[model samples]
Target chain A: MSLVTDKIISKPKIETRDLGLEMTENNRSLIEISNFDFFYGEKQALFDVSMDIKEREVTAFIGPSGCGKSTLLRCINRMNDLIEVARIGSGKITVNGVDIYDDRVDTIELRKRVGMVFQKSNPFPKSIYENVVYGLRIQGITRKSKLDEAVERCLKGAALWEEVKDRLDTSGLSLSGGQQQRLCIARALAVEPDILLMDEPCSALDPVATAKVEELIHTLKDRYTIVIVTHNMQQAARVSDRTAFFYLGKLIEMNATDQIFMSPDKEQTEAYISGRFG
Target chain B: MKRYFHEELEEIRSHLMLMGEKAVESVKLAMQALLESDIELANQVMESDDVIDDIEKQIDDEVVRYVSLRAPVARDLRLLFVAIKASHDLERVGDEASNIAGRTKKILAQGLPIDAVARVPRMCELAINMLEDSLRSFIQEEESLAYSIVGRDREVDTLNRENFKELVELMKSDSANVSACTEMVFISKSFERIADHAKNIAEEVFYLLTAQSLKEVTRGK
Candidate 1:
C-alpha cells in the first residue's frame, strides 16, 4: 500500500495554453474534462473524472467489463444522449475550449466534429460507395464529383480502397466482416471530424482484419485525434500513443503507452495489466 | 475470475525456482570437488549438467507458450521476458559449473597440490551465495535485495582477479606445476563468469520488480 507508483505525466494548465507561454505539444490539452460526473438515472456511473485527450494522439481506455470506459467515451460526443435514462450530473467537458454540455451545443453538430466507430461493423445496407458518402449526403452534399472524391479518399484512408474500389456498387453488407468495419471507419472519416472515438472497433474482426484497423489507426492519428475503448490490452498497447486505465468508474492512471504496459505507476494498473485484478 | 493464464505464470515461476536451485547446487558441488579433489564428485557435477539443461529448456518452452497464449502486459510482461533471459543465464551458470568440474578432472589426474587451486573454491563460495540470493530476490520481488546482490558481484570479481594472480605466480615459479596452474586459471575464470551470471539475474530481477534496471538506480555504499 505504501508504494507510490502513480508517476503519470502531469496535465497542462488551461491558463498556460490561453496565455501562449507554454505552447509545447506536451502542454496541449485538446479535450479537457474537469471534475465530470455522469449518471444513469439513480446510479452514478462516473465520479469526478478529469483527464485530457491531446491533439492528434490516440488515447486508449482499457479496463474490466462495466468499468465505465465505454461510458466515458460516450460522453465525449454526447453518444449517451440517446439513452433516455442517461444524464450528465455536473462538471464541464470542453472540446476546443467550448463546453459541450451547454444548452446551445447541438448533439448532432457535436457528433459531426467527433466521429465514432462501434464494436460491431454497423455499415448501412446501402452500397459501399453510398455508405462512405452517406454522412455527406445527409448533410446535403450532392455533387457527383464531391461524393465520388469523398468515397475514394475515405476508403483509401481506411485502407479498403484497393480491395473494394472495383466493387463500389456492391452492398456494404456483402463485404467481409473486416472490410465492413473498414467501411464504417470510412463513413466516419467522410465527415472530416477533428476527433474520432472508437468503442472497440476491432472487437469483432479476425486477427488479420484487426491488424489492418490497428495499422489504420496508427496513420489516422496524424490528421485526427483518436480515443479508443478496448478490452484488448495488447491492441491498446500497439496502437495508442498514450493509455488511460479506468477501474470502478474512476480514472486510475494515464501515461505513455509503453510506460503503462511495461511499468505502470499504480498498483491497480499493475494488477489489471498482470491479470491479477479480481 | 481466475483465468488459467495466471496459473501458467505461476507454473513458469515454480519451474524457474527449480532451475535456480539446480544452478546453485551445481556450482556448490563443483567447488567442493575442486577443494577436496574428489574426482567422483567432479564427475557427478559434470554428469548432472543435462538435468540443469533440461530444466532450462522446459522453462523456455513454458514461457514461450505463456506469451503466445496470454500476451501478458505490464508486470506479467516483464516477468515473462525476465523469465526467458534469466533461464538462459541460469543454463549458462550450469555450464560454467560443469566447466569448473571439467578443469578439476584434470587437476585430479595431474595430482597437483590442491592448495594452489584452493582460492578458486573460496571465490566460488561468494559466487554461489550471490546466485542463491539472486534467486530469492526474484521469487520475493525484492528490488533492494537484488541491488544488494548486484553490489556483491564486485567482490567475487575481485577474488577471481586475486586468485588468478596467485596461480600465475605459482606457475611462473615452478615449471612442473604449470599444467595444474593452467587448469586453476580456467576454474577461476569460470567462477568470475558464474558471478556475472548471478549479477545478470539480479539485475533482471530488479527490472522485473521495479520495472527499472538496477544499474540505472543510484547504489548506496
Candidate 2:
C-alpha cells in the first residue's frame, strides 16, 4: 500500500474575489506547508509540521526551549541553508504557490523576497543611509538619487523616518536600542521583501522598547506577511493573528491566537499557555 | 508562574462551601424553631443570615479581583462563573431561612393552636434534604447526582402543592383557623422557593460539567 492516499474530496466551491461569496474579508494565504520535516545531522528538529501563513497576517511560533520554533521559522526563507548539517526531508514548502525548495529557485532571490530580522539589533557598522541601502548596493544599484529615495521610503515604512531622517549620514550604532531595532526593520524593508521573519526580535529589549517593536509589528502586517517566533506567551497573544505551539520537535497545536491562549484544544497547549510549565 | 488566580479560585470554593454549610444550618435551625416553638432558635437563624450575606460579598469581591487581574479562561472561567451564581443562590437560601424564621415568630406569637405542626415539619425536612443534596452535587461536581436532585424537585413540588391544598381545606373547615393556616401557606411557599433555588444550583452544576445550559436541556426534555 502507498504511504499516502490521494482521496477525492469535495468542498463548497467559493470564488476567491467575490464579495458575495461568504468569504472572510482577509482571505489570502501567502505560504503553505505540508508534512514538512527538518533535521540537523542525525537529529530531527521538526516532525510532520503543516500550517498556513495568511497574507497581511502576523503568525507567532511559541514553545519551550529547544522545541524547534526557531528552526521552523527559518524554514520559510530556507535560512537553514547556511547550516551545513541541516536537511529537509519528505515535505513541501510553498510561498504564493511557488515551491521554495525547488532546484530552479534562486536562493538569493528567495532571500530578497523573504527578509529576516534577528533577536539582537544587528545593525552593520556603517552610516544609517548605507545600512538601509546595503542590499541595493550589493545589487550594484549605484544611483545616489535612487538610494536616497529608497532610504526615505524604507525608513518611513519602518516608522523610523522622523527619528533618523536628520541623522541619515550618522553611524547606525549611534541610535538607541529600540531605534536600532527599527533601523534593522528599515534595512529589511529596503530589500522590498514580501515576507518578514522575526526570531525573538524583542527578547533583548526593555519593556518600553519591546512595546514599540510589537506595535510596529502590528502596523507592518498591513503590508508584509509576518512570521515571528517568541517565547513569551503574552507577546504571542498580543501580536499574532494565529499561533502555533511546538513541543519537543513536534507541532502540537495550531489555531487562532485567541483560541490558543484562551482555550487551547490540546491539554499540553493549555498547560503551557496557563503557565503550568514551559 | 505564580498561579495566584488559581489560588484565589480555590479560596472562593472553600468560602462558598462554608457559606453553604451555614445556610443549611440556618434552615435546619429555623425549622427547629417552628417545630419546638422556640424564639431563641429563630433568632439564631436570623443572626446567621448576616454571616451568609458577608461571605457572599467576600466571594463576589474575590471573583471580581480574579477576573480583573488574571482574565481566567476555559474551566477556570466556568468555575468562576458558577461560583458567582452559587453564591447568589446561597445568599437567597439565607434569605429563605430568614423568611422561615419570620413565620416561626408569627406562629409563636399567636400560639400554635392545636395539633397542626406535623405536616409542616415533614415538608421542611424534605426541602432541607433537597438543599443539602444539591449543594453536595455542586461541590463534588457530580452531574448524575445533580440530575437526581433535579428529579427530586418534583417530589418537593408535589409536597408543597398538597400541603397548600391541605392548609386551604383546614381554613375552610374552621374560620378561626385562618390566621394559622395563612402562616402555614407562607411557610410552604418558602419551602417551594427554596426547592426552586436548589434546582437552579443543580442546573448550574450541570452547566459547569457539560457546558450546556440547563434551560436548553429542560426545553428539549
Candidate 3:
C-alpha cells in the first residue's frame, strides 16, 4: 500500500480475521469501537457507542449540535486527551484490532497514523513548503533533498501542488481560505497518516472551495481511511460510504450512506437527516 | 414542524394527485363515451388528455427542483423518486385513456352497437379501481393497499384476453362487423395497458412506503 510508509512507526498487529470480523475488499474493518463511553470531567458525553469503520472508505458522522459526533471522532486518535477534563469512561476503541487506548501504545506514533484537519485551516505562518514538511522536520529529517521530496509528494497528495507549485516559498497564510484548508490537508498528509479525521473541514469554506476540498477527500479515501464529522447532511451524503448518526451523545444509527439517506432503518436517523428535528 | 420546502413537496404531491384524478377521469369519460356511443364525449375525452400531460410535466419539474435544491433524504427523498416514477405511469394512463377515446370515436362513427365492446367496461372499472387504490395508497402511505392492487392487475389482464377472443370471433362470424370488432379489440388492449400502468403505480407506492420491490416480493410467491 502506498500510504503504509516507513513513517507509520508501529502498525497495529491484530488482523481482521483473528478478530472474527467479516472481511471483503470494501468492508475490511479498520477501526472498531465497542461499547465505548466517554466523559468530560463529571458529565458523560458518549454512551456505549460502537461501530466498525471500513478501511479505505469515508465514514461520516452527522447529527445536531453537541451530539458527540466530534467527540467520538476525536477519540479515534485520542485528541480528547488534550482537554483537561476529558476521559474515557468505559469500553475500548481499536485500530487494526489493537486497543488504541492501551498503555503500551505510543501517543505520538498513534497520531502519526491518524492525522486530523480542523474546521478552521491553521497554517504555521511559514512557507507552503515548510508547512507540508513540518511534521517530518520536527521528527529531525533535515536533509534538503528529503524535505524537498516530502513537500512535493505531500502537496500532490493533497491536490494543492498544481495551484501553488509556483509559490512554494510563499507564506502558507497567503493562500486563499480553500487553498489554506487544502494546505492543512497537505500538512496532514506529510506524515502519511493511515487515517484522516476531519471535523467540518468545509464549514469555513465557500461552496466552490468546499467542492474542491470535497473532491480532494473523495480522492484521498483511496489511500486513507477517512472519518468526517459534519452538520451538513448533503456533504455527508455526497462524501461518505457509510454514515453514523448520533444524538445526545448516543449512537442512534449507522448504515451504508445510500441506506441512511434513502431509507434509514431508524426513524431518528431519518428525522435528523431530513431536518425534521434537532 | 415541517420545513419550508416541504410545501414544495406538498405541491408536487398535489400535482401528482391532480394528475391521477385527471387520469382516472379520462378513463371514466372514455368508458362513458364508448357506452353511450357519444361522439361529443369521446372528443372531450381526447381533448382533455393534454391536461393530464401538462400536470405530469409540472410534477416532474417540481420533483427535479426539490431534489436539486432541497436535498431531501430518507422518506422525503424516497417520496421524490416515487413522484417522478408514478407521474410517468399516470401520464401513460392518460395516453391509454386518450387512445381508448379515439377508438370509441371510430366505433361511434361507424354506428356500431355498444355491446360490441363486451368486456371493456368491466376491464375499465377494475383498472380504474386499481388506479384509485394505488393513488390512495400513495396519499395515505398504505403499504398493504399498494401490494393488494398488484394482484388485481391479473384480473384485468384475464378480461382483456377474453375480450380479444370474443371480438375476434365476432369479426369472423360477420365480416360486416369487422371494423367495429377491430376497434373493440384495441380498446380492450388499451384498458389492459391502463391497468398495467396502474399496477406500476401501485408497485411504486409500495416502494415509496416500504422501500421494498413488490415485483421481487411477489416473484417468490
Which candidate ranks first by TM-score, i.e. highest?
Answer: 3
Worst 10 residues of 2 chain A by lDDT: A1-10
**Best-to-worst lDDT order:** 3, 1, 2
Interface RMSD of each: 9.5, 9.1, 9.0
lDDT of 3 by residue, A1-278 (tens): 12222223364443334333233255688899999999998999999999999999999999999999999999998888677788898999988777878755566767878899999999999999989989998889999999899888988988899999999999999999999999999999998688899999999999889888888898898888899999898888777889999999999999888778877899888887777885
Q: In model 2, where do residues sit more than 4 Å from their true spots?
A: A1-25, B1-221
Clashing pairs in 3: none
lDDT of 2 by residue, B57-82 (tens): 99988777566435577878888898
- Those runs of model 3 whose alpha carbons end farther than 4 Å from true positions after fitting are A1-26, B1-180, B183-221
Worst 10 residues of 1 chain B by lDDT: B1-10
Question: Between prediction 1 and prediction 2, which has the larger lDDT?
Answer: 1
Clashing pairs in 2: none
lDDT of 1 by residue, A3-51 (tens): 1111111222222223231232543677898998999999999989999
* Regions of candidate 1 where Cα sits further than 4 Å from its true position: A1-27, B1-221
Candidate 3 has an lDDT of 0.86
Tens digits of per-residue lDDT, candidate 2, A1-278, equal 11111110122222222212123236477788899999999899999999888888999999999999999899888878777788998798988777777755556667777899999999999999999999999989999999999999999988899988888999999998988999999999998887899999999998788878887897898778899999887778777888999999899999887677666899999888877974
Task: Specify the highest-DockQ model's number.
Answer: 3
lDDT, model 1: 0.85
